[model samples]
Target: MRILLVEDDAMIGEAISQALKDACYAVDWVRDGQSALSTVHRQRYDAMLLDLGLPHKDGLEVLRVLRAKKHSMPILIVSARDAVEDRIQGLDSGADDYILKPFEMAELLARIRVTVRRNAGIAAPTLSNGMLSLDPASREVTVDGVATLLSAREFSLLQALLIRPGAILSRVELEDRIYGWNEEVESNAVEFLIHSLRKKLGSSTIKNVRGVGWLVSKGE
Candidate 1:
């Protein structure tokens, strides 16, 4: 899934962006509230990581404006502002969750998953397609009663497909979901990962249409 990361601190922003990418998430980063506002209107993000302090406009104002316009994208406030009032204000302004600064990357990723799943109205952490089972909370995959070890990119690719098992996703769409804005993608990156997953999950686990794209097998 794609995430919008808004932070003005160069060091902090870079760190978060890299961490998100490492976790197999697509990230688009912006440095100011105005830019954040503009991107929200222009781009499709599964969730947003917002900071309270921002330039050209306060992040809180951005939150309020987005909520005012009735946008339902899940927003998580990640700031150094750990005060109770700050947390309350962020939630009141439409943020779905709040994470204090100096936070653990794992926790941030977990919260992002929770926020996105909550938005999707999905309560189960384990997503399944046919005989394949993936536990998002545990980051584990089991197929046909056997466990499978998948790389981060492999898992992300499978999750993207399992989320909508029979839906065909173009290479560009899968790439958009699998890599961050800054990552270098080889020409056959998706094919390579798809090969790995198919090798492990079963050859028929995924199918490719010559020029169309790829998709997980549909259940009978």
Candidate 2:
């Protein structure tokens, strides 16, 4: 899933970004509320981690504006403000959850999962396309009842493709989902990863759309 993290503290942002990446999330982090607002307005995200204290604009104002614009994306407040009134105000501002700073990474991740599931109206842990199944929580993939082990990048690539079966995803879009925005992308990285995934999953599972992009067919 994609997440936007709005945090001003460099150290805390780095830590949360790394943790979210480790959990296989596409994260876009901004240092201030203005950048965060710009990002949320421009791109789609599964959830948001917002910090109250921010430069340029307060995070509360950011949330308020988003709600005013009718952006229904799930938002979780992650702030150093632990006071009861602060939490109440954050929720009143339309935050889905409130998490105080110095929180456990595991707890934060758990909350994110809940928010994503709630937004997507999903109650299951497994996502499937035909006989192929993926367990997002376990990072496991199974094709036609057979378990297929994949490298981290390979798994990420397949997950991205499978999530939107039959939809053509451009190389740039795939790269954005598989690798961080700051990472150096090899010229043929997407092609290489697609080749590898096809080899493991089945040669006919993924379709190349000529010059357009790639797509996982709806059924085998």
Candidate 3:
């Protein structure tokens, strides 16, 4: 999954970015609300981590504009604001969830997984097509009861396809799922990942529809 991270504190932002990347998310980190707005408008993200106190534009203003534009990606507020009213205000302003600073990393990750999964129309924590099961929270892929590992990008690509097994997704669509704004993609990046996944899972696991696109073979 891809996430937009808007935080001004250099240390906190770096930590959050590293953590998210380690968890298999492609993240675009911006320090101010204006940059956040620009990034969101131009790029696709599964969710956002926004801080209320921001340079250039206040975070609440960012939220208002995003909602006004009918943007529906989940937003999670991670701010120093800890008062009851602050939480209420953030939620009322269109944030899907709120986390105060000095929070546990595990809880933060859990909330992000829940928010992104909810946006994907998923009610369950694990996704599977027959014996191939993936656990987003654990970043684990298991086939036939045996555990396997996937690189962060490989995992993101698989998750995108697994979201709608049997639905053909074009190369451009898969690229968007695996990349963030401002990142340069190699011409055959998607194909490389697809090849890697096939080697790990099995050659027949995914199907390519010639000039159309790619898909996971539908489970019977």
Cα misplacement distance, residue 129 of candidate 3 (Å): 3.0
- Segments in model 1 whose C-alpha atoms lie over 4 Å from true places: 209-211, 217-220
Q: How high is the CA lDDT of each candidate model?
A: 0.87, 0.85, 0.89
**Candidate 2 local lDDT, 1-220, one digit each (tens):** 6789999999999999999988888788999989998888787777899999999999999999999999999999999999999999999989999998899999999888777766765666666668688777677889868887677788777777776777899998888777655768899999998898888888887889899999887775
Q: Ten residues in a row with the worst lDDT in model 1?
A: 130-139
Model 1 agreement with the true structure over 29-101: per-residue lDDT tens digits:
9999999999888877788999989999898999999999999999999999988999999998999999999
Per-residue error at 20 for model 1, in Å?
1.8
The C-alpha stretches of model 2 lying farther than 4 A from their native spots are none
- Of the two candidates 1 and 2, the one with more favorable TM-score, higher being better, is 1
Residue pairs clashing in model 3 are none
Per-model TM-score versus the true fold? 0.87, 0.86, 0.92
Candidate number of the best lDDT: 3
lDDT of 3 by residue, 1-220 (tens): 8889999999999999889888888888999999999989888888999999999999999998999899999999999999999999989989999999989888999999898778878888887777588888777888888878788888999998888888999999998888876679999999999999889988888899999999986586
Task: Find the number of clashing residue pairs for candidate 1.
Answer: 0
lDDT of 3 at 210: 99
TM-score of 2: 0.86
